[model samples]
Target: MTKEIFDDIFGKGNSNWQKVSFLRRCFFNDNGITVNWRANTPLIKLWKQAKDLDEFKVLLKKDKDAQKLQFTHEWLKTADKDYDQYLASIIKETATMQYDVWSDAGSVKVGNAQFSFLISHNNGDGHAIAAVFKNEKDFISSPMKFITSVEGTFNIYDYDCGQNVIVTLNGRYDVYVYCGITCFVKK
Candidate 1:
């Protein structure tokens, strides 16, 4: 419910969470396969006008020689060190693919989601969170109605927090999410 986990915002119109929570955290810039961060200032434009995943990848890979490329270490070489990691981290998050069904590992789907998470007790034993919505699955199943599946991580929350997440998908035209402590665990 807290978007403060990674200091990244989590709410309507937010898209970065889907990438990392669904796939892996190590994202790429030149392509969305590694991450899909939208620069505070927009970056290179994707060609082919892809709306779907496959098309987006083709678009993301296009026009490689157009601008300066960045890497984790390379970006750090510049004046700002922290910002470089932050930028690269967001990029790496974009590379992950989306899917459904919860698998033990090696898959993008979390059933709900399984974005790679890291936890810290520096604040307290109780966990803190910061999540991002990645995708949604709608159908006529027992679950019924809208089923949104997001992909975000808790760099500061408990590693188990993602598992305990009890998600309730709200029906809305555009992307919608409800966050907050629905319940607390006494551990």
Candidate 2:
């Protein structure tokens, strides 16, 4: 029975026997209070919280934990892209020697770059072309592996001019010569 009903039944008189007990009426009671209570109050108090600038400053002390990098590869890919762009910029700096139009016999001396390339008619041996990319393994070098002869993809690891190609990061500035196969890059 509720305290109100009990009090109504037996008036609020200090008649000892009429002093009703305030026992737990609700099932989930802490102290005669409902345990399964739900308040309409929201979690965020819009404007009621007191702002303490000084106390906040005191509490917001500098963090002691080092700012460790989390999964640096995510941004590392960005760095890779940046380095790739830088390498591409350097490749552009040297200017591509792509000036092939049709199978013909000729040699080109790249301006101020000390690079030499030739396309010659092997008479009957299909084709025989070679380029002397000096000090230029970045563009062409000595591990000079060929990825594909048909596609004209090639790689070199050393330089005749003692220059380092694919330095710092590998496969940055890819160099290939589509010999005697007219692969001209229009500026």
Candidate 3:
């Protein structure tokens, strides 16, 4: 029994005895409690939200581990307050090229802060991570990779950017693209 029930029946003097007998009670005295003990509480919510078992498993796995990705084509999608765009110039530049690097990214911005994530498939891909700053040089056509954790999320900090400036993800050596999402909050 739980401590609450045990205490009510035998009084507080039985507390130590309850602890001493916990293993035996768990093993043979209570079948219902034993069965529920190993149950995962989050799985119930996951099952409710999921369309099927396969989708449920996918959601569980995404939570349990980071996924790997590969990029073979390059494109850019960007957004600010007034407009969002697919940069045609970058799309044209990467059209004739092929990128074969293992890469992954998923970023979300909240309020004035943006959380970034990226991962290189391996070290052989000839690229380095750099932050996409507000003011970039003339020949720098894309945002370079920035520092990230091993699992790919960036270390949280105040990101520097201008209100009207455009920031986009780019690979140093090859073509790559990822899904971009934006959410807004009222000041």
Indicate which candidate wins on lDDT.
3
Which tens-of-lDDT digit does each residue in 68-159 have in candidate 1? 23322232233243432333333234312211212232121122343443222122323222223333221101111222332332221223
**Candidate 3 deviates by what RMSD?**
19.7
**Per-residue lDDT value at 117 in model 2:** 40
What TM-score does each of the candidates earn?
0.18, 0.17, 0.17
**Once superposed on the true structure, which residue ranges of model 3 sit more than 4 Å away at CA?**
1-40, 57-121, 128-187
lDDT of 3 by residue, 1-187 (tens): 2434323433435455554344324322243234342344443344446675356445543432111110001111111221112222332232332222221223221122354333332232232222232222211222222232222222321222212223333322221223221111011
Best by TM-score: 1
lDDT values of the candidates? 0.27, 0.26, 0.28
> Clashes per prediction?
24, 11, 4
Instruction: For model 3, name the residue pairs that clash.
Output: 74-176, 129-145, 130-145, 130-146
Model 3 scores a TM of 0.17
**When superposed on Cα atoms, how far off is each prediction in RMSD?**
18.8, 29.0, 19.7
